[model samples]
Target: MRMIVMIIFLVLLGLLAILNRHFLTYPHTLNLGFAEYKDMPVGLMLLAASLIPMLVFYFWASVTKLRAQADTAKLLRDMESLRTSLDSQEGSRFQQLQAHLDRQFAEMQTQALPSSGSASEVASLAAKMDAMKRDLDLQLDQMDDYLKRKLG
Candidate 1:
């Protein structure tokens, strides 16, 4: 879009210059504080002055756009790295929790097999596991919400 606009502006400026060729080429005097320029094509000089700034601005905008794209790409790479690290950490934590739960169940089975209250003990353990599951799910949901908020 910017390119199109720039091209149109250049074409219009070219047409105007072409239509006013005689005026643009006509000689005149230019004065500065310390020097004077005689027989100068003042119109052409003004045209060059206008074009220089426009060209500088166009290049500046292109460089700024490229910098912005590079920054966005860097941000996405950082986000992806962070997400992968978080996933790995979560996986390790889950593995640790599973190991702990397995150990606890093994201990419970060994102790309960010789007791009469084994059924009640199993039910209590099941309830505790269910509670832990709910807590884990809540934590996961909170983490998900946090990630969504950050990304958005």
Candidate 2:
């Protein structure tokens, strides 16, 4: 929207310049290191001078826009790559944690379920199993919360 308004304003300015072309009347001349010119109008000269800066501004704007687009594209690609890497890493880590948890539970079962011939021994073993289960649940809940925060 801003670009459209700017373009409209530039067109009006150019029209104004063209309409005021007769502001210069006397003969005018210009010379350069490599060339020479004569009979140039002051109004026309003013218009050309104004157009030179506008042209330069347009070229600079285009170059800057292209650079910005390239940067954005590069950033998007990097983001996608990072996302995929994180996903793969997350899956592998979850699997590793699950396997580790299963091993720990199996070890706990083998140690807790045996040699419970007496009532007191059975009670102690039951208490130990409950503590291990609570610990495992706490760790799992912490892991879940960490993953939710990280992913979000």
Top candidate (lDDT): 1
| TM-score, one value per model | 0.63, 0.56
Sliding window of 10 residues with minimal summed lDDT for model 1? 143-152
Query: What RMSD does model 1 have?
Result: 4.8
lDDT by residue (74-136, candidate 1, tens digit) is 997799788879988988998899899889888887878777699678878878997998899
For candidate 2, what is the lDDT? 0.72
Q: Which residue runs of candidate 2 sit more than 4 Å off their true CA positions?
A: 24-38, 104-152
Q: For model 2, how does the per-residue alpha-carbon lDDT over 1-152 read when each residue is reduced to its tens digit? A: 44676698789987886676567444577766687778867666766778788778777888899899999879777766786677679768877976886787667667666555654565676678678867977886787677556644
Provide the overall lDDT of each model, using Cα atoms, as 2-decimal numbers: 0.89, 0.72
